[model samples]
Target: MPYLAHIGPIAAIVAGVLILVMPRLLNYIVALYLILDGATRLLR
Candidate 1:
């Protein structure tokens, strides 16, 4: 998970793994990813 060095990246990786375990969580994960990414971009 070297690519997932940051909190956001780590969350993304965890989300991906969670999705594999429970496909229903994909929507939530993607939504969260987008929200976090958007927040980071906007704040930065």
Candidate 2:
């Protein structure tokens, strides 16, 4: 499979695991994701 095809699911699983392990990190993770996502969209 192409790497891009796997990225979404893998990212979700990793994020879920991180949240489960460190609930406190949820805010940071979400904020970072939003920033990165917005940056990518703007760049594109």
Candidate 3:
């Protein structure tokens, strides 16, 4: 599978859990995720 295919599900699960456990982290998680995703794509 392509990296993005894995990223979606993993990010979703992590974001979901984090949102439930620590709502404050939602923004950071999303920002980190986008940054990582963009970096990954650019680096690839």
Candidate 4:
């Protein structure tokens, strides 16, 4: 799962940038991350 491992940091960075550049996107980014994370965990 090298791709998955690589994406984790990239996602974090994107979320960080979104938070910095447009604070409004922070909530959407966080919600998306959480939903995806939960889905992945549950599916696994």
The all-Cα superposition gives candidate 1 an RMSD in Å to the true structure of 4.4
Model 4: per-residue Cα lDDT over 1-44, one tens digit each? 44555555677788888899999888899998777666555554
Clashes of each: 0, 0, 0, 0
* TM-scores of all predicted structures: 0.68, 0.62, 0.60, 0.69
RMSD of 4: 2.0
| Order by TM-score, highest first | 4, 1, 2, 3
- Residues 11-32, candidate 2: write the lDDT tens digits: 6677778999999999987777
Each model's lDDT: 0.78, 0.70, 0.78, 0.75
Candidate 4: TM-score?
A: 0.69
Which residue pairs collide in model 2, if any?
A: none
Best by TM-score: 4
Of models 1 and 4, which has the larger lDDT?
A: 1
Q: How close is candidate 3 to the true structure, as a TM-score?
A: 0.60
Candidate 2: residue 34 Cα off by (Å): 4.4
Tell me the tens digit of each residue's lDDT in model 1 across 1-44: 44333767777788889999999888888999898877765665
Clashing pairs in 1: none
lDDT, candidate 3, 1-44, per-residue tens:
37655775687688889989999898898898788778666765
Q: Please report how far candidate 4 places residue 22 from its true position, in Å.
A: 0.4
The list of candidate 3 runs beyond 4 A from truth reads 1-4
